[model samples]
Target chain A: MHYFDCCDFTIASEIAWPVSFPASREPEVEIRYRNLPTDLGEGGERGFRFHAKPNELLICVDGVARYLIRGGKEIWIEPFPHADEDSIVAFLQSSVLGVLLLQRRFLVLNGGVFNVDGEGIALVGCSRAGKSTLAAAFQRIGASLFSDELCAIKQDSSGRMMAWPVLPALSLWENTLIQQGGDVTKLRPIRPSIRKYLVPTHAKSLSPVPLTQVVELKDYHGDLLWKTVDVKEAITLVLGNTYRHRFLIGMALKDAHFLQSTALIQQSRFYIAQRHLTVTSEDAFFHFVRTNLAL
Target chain B: MKSIVWLASYPKSGNTWLRIFLENLFFATDEPCDINNLRSSFMSCSLDLFDHECGWDVSLLSHDEIDRLRPEIYTYIDSQWENVKYFKTHCAYSFTGSGEAFFPDEATKAAIYLIRNPLDVCISYAHHRGYSDYDRIIAEMADAASCLCSDTDQPFWQARQKILSWSLNVESWLSVEGFPVLFLRYEDMKNNPYEAFSRVAAHLGVNKSELEIRQAIKNSSFEELQKQESLNSFKEKPSRSKKFFRSGQNGMGYAMLSRSQVASIIANHGQIMAQFGYL
Candidate 1:
C-alpha cells in the first residue's frame, strides 16, 4: 500500500489504479483513490474518490462523477448534467487542494494569520471586498508578501500551525494598481468582466512562516469599529468565508480538524473590524498593519 | 376613485425624480423625500409599506423567503389598495405571474416606461454604487447585455433578461387595446420637463396647470433630490469601506467612456433606445 502522510491524517490505499506512462516508460504521476471516513456525521458520511487520469481528472461522489478533460475548460458530469460548470471547477480546486490535499486541517484563526514572530498579518475577505488593496497596503510597509488569493495552513509535529505560501499574486482594480506603484505590463486581461488586474508580488525573500492570526476583512461602515471574537466564533466565520465546496472530505475528520484548528485560533486573538470607508493606498494599509499588529 | 399612477423605470433612470415631482405637487410640503415615511403615508397599502407595517412577521424571513411570499402578500394588499395606489418598480413588465395582478392586471394600470440610454444608465450605476474599478463595471454591463439578448427559455441571466424583456413588454402593452401606456424618455424629461410632466399628469387624470408642472419640475430637480435626506439615505448596513448612495448625475457616461465606447453602447441597446425616440 502506498501511503501519503500530511500531518495527523494518513491516506493508505492498495488499489492498482491505472497509471499513465510517458515515452520514457516512466509513470509521470501515481493515482490512488479510496472511500475514507470524513467523520462530519450526516454531511460527511459521503466519500470522495479522485483519479488523476492521463492529462485529465475525475472525481466521484454521491453516485455522480465529474470528468475534467485538459483541453476543454468545462467540466462534464454524468447523471447530474445540469450542475453549473464553473461552480464545479471552483469546487474541485478548493476541495482537492484545500481539504483533501492538505489532509483536512484548520489553519486560519481570529480574522488574521500571524507571521513567524507574529510580526506580519494577512487579511482575507470575500471577492470585491478589498483584500488585494489591503495586501498592497501591507506590502508598501515592507512586510513580506505570501499571497492574496489562496494560503495553505499546516500543523507541524510540534502542534504549531504554519501558513504555507501559495502564489504571490494580488488582484486589484486599475486605479488601485496605479496607486500601489504597480506596472501595467503586470496586468492580465480577465475578460468578459471589466476593471480587474492581477499584479504579482516581487517579494521572494520571504518563505512560508508560522501563522498567528486570521482577520476576516470587511468594509468600513459609518464609523471605525473593531471587536475581538472568541475562537469558536472565528472558526464559524472563517468557515462561512471559505471557498464554496460541493463535497467536503471525511465528516468526523473535518470536525476534529476544525476543533483543533479552533484551539490554535483561541490561543491567539480574533477580531471583527469596521474601518474608515476610504480607498487608502498600500503604504497606508501596511502602516496600519504595523501599528495594529505591533510588529 | 382617485387613480394611482405607477411611475416605473429601470434603476438610475429617474424613478425618484418622478416620485419627488408628484409628492411636491400633491403634498405642497418639502418634508423630505422619505420613501419609508411616504410609503406609510399615502401609499401605505403598497408593498414597501406592508414590509414595515407587518414588521416582525415579514422581516424575520430571509430575502428569498420574502420573495417567495411576495405574490401572496401582494394579493392581500391588492385587495386593500384596489382603488388608490401609486407604486414604483424597477422590475420589467409582465413580472406579475399568473393570477397575481396587484395593480389592475398590468393591463389597466398606467405603466410609464421611462427609457434611458444604456451608456448613461451604466455610468450612473457605476458611480451611484462603489465598484472596484472600470473593468468590474464593464463586466457587469456585458453580463446584463448578454442576459437581455438571450432567449427567455434559458435559465441563466435572470436579472439581465428581465431588463431586456421590458422593451418587448412595453411594445406589447402599447399595441394592446384598453390600459393606458405612456412612453417617456429620460433624455426628453431632462430636455423638456414641463412638456413631459404635463403629458404624464394628463394621462393620470390629474389637472396640472403650466405653473404647477413648472413647480413640480423645479422641486424635483436633481439638486433638490440630492438635498433631500431621505432620498439620498440607505437603510441597509454598509459593507466594508463602501456606501449606498454615492452620486446622482446625467451624462456621466460621456465623462467615463470614449466616443467609440459610447457608439458600442448605443449599438448594444440601440433597438430599445430607438423605440423610445432616444436616438
Candidate 2:
C-alpha cells in the first residue's frame, strides 16, 4: 500500500501506482484528497476528497479514504488496474499528463469535454458529434487549441476568467484521422463498434485562447444549417450534451463552484449546427465550419 | 377480476396521441394534456423502475437471460399493477419464457395498438434519433417484424424494429380470444380525430356524448399538447432537449426514402401495415 499525506488527511491503498506523476515542491495553493472505500459490485469502491484553504471537494466511495495530498499542478489519474508496464506508461502519458495540462479545476466525463470560450461560445454535442472533429479543423486553420477533450476554467487572483488545456491529445475517428492524414498506428482500440485514435496537439498550440463562440453539431436530413441561440437555450443544450455520468449531475447540482462555473459558461455565445446530411468526406464538415464559424 | 390495459406501439407511432385521447376522454378534465402526468397517472412501467426494484442488473444480463426474464418480469409486473393499469411496453410480440404467449395471461382491461407504415416509421426514427443510413434501418425493421411474427425472443436491431414489433405485439394481443382490442392507425388519427377517438372511447366502454368526445379530441390535438407547458418538461435525467412533438403529419417519411426502400418495407410488413390502413 502506498501512503500519501497532506494537510488533515492520509490514504493507503493496495492498488499500485501504474504511472508516476511529476511531483511539485512549490506551494501555491494546498488541497488534500483521500480515496474512500466502496462496495459497488465491480470490486471495491475507490474515492478521494480535495480540501483547499477555504473550500473542500470530498469524493467518497464505499467507506475507505486512500490518497491525501496537498494541491500541486492538478490531480492525475492513471486509469486504474493496469495489467502491464507499457499500458501503465501509456496511461501516464495519455491520462495523467492530460490532467496536468488542465490549467484550472474541471471534471472529466466519458473522456470528453464541454468547454465554453471566453467570448461565450459553448461547443456542445453528443459523442461523435464532431467536437474533436471541429477542434482539429480549427487547429489546421491556425486557431490555438486550448484542449482536445477536457479543459480547466478558473478565476485568477485578479478575478479574470481563464481556460486551460486538460488533455494533450484529441481522439479522432478513423474517418477523421484519414481526413487529417494522422498516423493510424498511434490509434488505441476503444471498442468493437467504432475506431478511435489519439492525436497529440502541438505544444505551441497549448496556450489558452479566449472562448468567443459555441457551436453544437447535430445530424439532420442531409443538409447543413446554422442558427444562433440565446444563453438560456445554450445552457440547456450544453447541459444536455455534457459528459452526463450519473454522479456528475448530482455533483453539478450540489457544488456551488461547479454551478457558478457552469453559469459563467452560460453567458457565452451558442449556436446549433445541423451538419450536412450526406458528406462525402470529413473535409466537407471542416469546410463548413471554416466558412461559417468566426474561428 | 382485475383488468390490465396495454398501451403499446412502435415508437413515435401515435402512442402518445392515443394516450392523450384516452386521458382527455376518461378523466373529463378541462385541464390541458400533460404527458408526464399522463404517464405517471396511468401507472406506466418502464425499464428504469424495473431495474431499481428487482436488482435485475439489466445492463449486465446476456441476451438469453433478457429473453428468459422478459416475460417473467412482465408477468410479475402485471400481477403487481393489477388495479386499473394502463401498461406501456416497447417489447415486440414474442414469448418471454412464460409460455408461448404473446401477452400476459390475465384478462386485458383493453388492448389498443397503433401502427404506421414501416417506411414512415423508418424515416421518422432515422431523422429523430440520428440514424445515419436507411438500409441498416430497414434491415432492423424487417428483423423486428419477423421476431414479432415468430413469437421468438430476440433483441431488436434498430429503433424502427422496436416500433414495428410494438405494433405486432399489439396485434397479437388483439388476436387473443376474449379480450377487448382496438386498432388505431396513425394516418386515421391524423386525418379524423373524432372518428378515431370515438372508436377508442367505445372500446374503453365509456359512454360519452359526441360533444364530449369532440372536446376530448380537441384537447388531445397535437397543437394543444405541444403548447401545454407540462408536456414540454421531462423529469428524467438526460432530458429530451428537443421538442418532443414534431410534425404530426402522415407520410412525411416519403420525402426522405427512395421509392424502392418504401416498396421494400411495404412488401415485408404489408399485411400488418395494411390491416391498420397504412397502405
Candidate 3:
C-alpha cells in the first residue's frame, strides 16, 4: 500500500496519491480500488449520487468512480478503467476528501488559503471569481502559501478551531498567469486538454493556523468594491462558499454544515472582494488589491 | 421523470422576453423577478452548472472536451431532478466529436425556437456585443460555423454556442429529431402579442384562464420590462449596451439597416426567409 499524509489523515491507498505531506503516522484510512456497489443502496437520488445513513455515505461518479466513506474513518474507492491518474486525483481532491471531511463533521470550506504573518487568509467565491489568482498574488508578494482550494477547520484539544492548510499547488487559468506577468511557457497544465496551469508553492506548511479573513470574490466589473458582511450574512455566505455545498446537501449533512457555518462565522471575519476582467487592464485591479489589502 | 422544456433561441431573439412572461405566469410576484436571480438555469452554456454536475471542474477541460461530455452532464441533471424544468439554450442541434448529440433526447421533451429576422438580429447583435461592424455581423449570420463566447482568455461565464447560420439555426431545431419543437418568429410575437403568447401559454401545458394569461401578458409587456430596467437594473445587460430592454420593434431592423444591408440578409437567408414570411 502506498501511504500519504493528507490533511492530518495518514491514508493508505492502492492508487498513489500525489500529496507531498510526509507519511509519518499510522494509516487511519484505507483507499481500495475495486468495483463499487451498483445498487447504491437504492432509495436516494441520481445524477450526482450520494446515499447516506448515520455513520456512512456512498458517492458515485457514473462510470468514473464510487467512494464509500464509512464511519468517517475509511474511504473505499471503486475506480473505472476510463478514469486516468489525473482524473482519479481530481475526484479525490475535488469532492471525495471534502465529502469525507464533511462526513467526519469537520468545518471545511471551498476557498484558497494563505498564511500572512502566521494568520490564515482565505479567498472564497464561485469558480472564475479569481480566488486562486488573488491567493497567488498574496504569496507572490511574500506570504507563505498555505493552501489553494480546499481548507479544513478543525478544533484543537483546547476547544479552539484553526484553519488547516491543504496541498501546496494552485490551479490557475492562463489569462490570470499572463495578467500577473508570469511566463506561461514554464508552467504545467493542470490536466490534459486544459490550459489552466498547476503552479507549485515554494514555501508551504501543513500545520494549522488561526484564520484572519475570508474575502468572497465577485466577477470583475468596474472597480474594486469591498463590502463588510455581518455575522448573519457571513454565516450564509460561508455555508454557500463551502466545498461542493450542493453535494453536502446530497450527503444529508446540512445540519452538520449549518453548525460548522455558525462556528466559522463566529471564529473568522468575512468580506466581499469585487473586481473586473479583460484582455488587458491598466493594472488597476491588481494595484488595488496589493495597496488596499496591504499584500 | 418529466423531461425539461427547452426555451431555445439564437442570440437577440425574444427568448428573454418570453421567459419574463412565463416567469410572471408561474411566480406572479407583486414585483418583477430580479434579473440577477432568475430561478431557471440555462440549458447549453452555463459553465458553473457543468462544473458542479460533472464533479470534475470543466474549467480544467478544453471546450472540445467539455463539449464531448455535454450529453452526459445534461442527462445526469435531467434524471436527477424529479420536477419538470424549463432550460434556455442557443446551441444549434449538432453532433459532438464522439458522433453523439451534444444535448440528449432522453433529457428533453419539447423545444421552442425563437427565430428573429436576420436583418434586425444583426443590429441587436452589434448592440449586444458592442460590435459596430454591420457587414461583419451579416457575414457571421450567413457563416455556418459562426459561434459566440468561445474565447479562452479567462473562462467565460457561458460555454461556446455554435448557433450556425441564422437560416440553419432555425432549420436545425425545427427539424431536430427525437423531440418536438415549435418555431415562432420575432415579428409574429411583436405583431400579435396576445395571440402569439396565448399559443405559447397553451403549448407549455400551463393551466390558466384567459384572464390570468392576459394579466401575465400585461405584466411582462415590453414597456413594463423597459420600465423595470429603468427602475432597478437588468443583470443580463452587457456592459456595452446602454440598456437591454431597448426598442422592441418589428420593423426597427429595416429602419436601421441600409437597402444593401437588408438585401444582403434577404439574399443569404432567402429560402428560410420566404418560409418564415420575411421575404
lDDT of candidates 1 onward, in order:
0.48, 0.50, 0.74
Decoy 1 TM-score against native:
0.44
Model 3 chain B: worst 10 consecutive residues (lDDT sum): B34-43
- Residue A70 in model 1: lDDT: 25
Rank ordering of all candidates by lDDT, starting from the highest: 3, 2, 1
1 or 2: which has the higher DockQ?
Answer: 2
Q: Using lDDT, give the best candidate's number.
A: 3
Using DockQ, give the best candidate's number: 3
**Collision count of model 1:** 31
Better of 1 and 3 by TM-score: 3
Model 2 chain A: lowest-lDDT 10 consecutive positions: A54-63
Ranking by DockQ: 3, 2, 1
**Model 3 Cα lDDT, one tens digit per residue, B120-238:** 88898888777788888899889999887787756577777788998888888877878878888878888887888888877777788777777778878888888878765566777
Q: Which has the higher TM-score value, candidate number 2 or candidate number 3?
A: 3
**Tens-place lDDT digits, model 1, residues A1-295:** 4333222233232321111111222222222323333222232222123433222334443212243322112233342454433333223323333433323344422122324353335576544445666666766656666656555566667766566544344545666666666675655532212244545564343335666656666555234445667856877666655432222232224454565556557554655554543443345545555566565
TM-scores for every candidate against the unseen true structure: 0.44, 0.51, 0.89
TM-score of chain A of each: 0.58, 0.60, 0.86
lDDT of 3 by residue, A214-275 (tens): 88876642445777889888977887788876656666778877776776777788887676
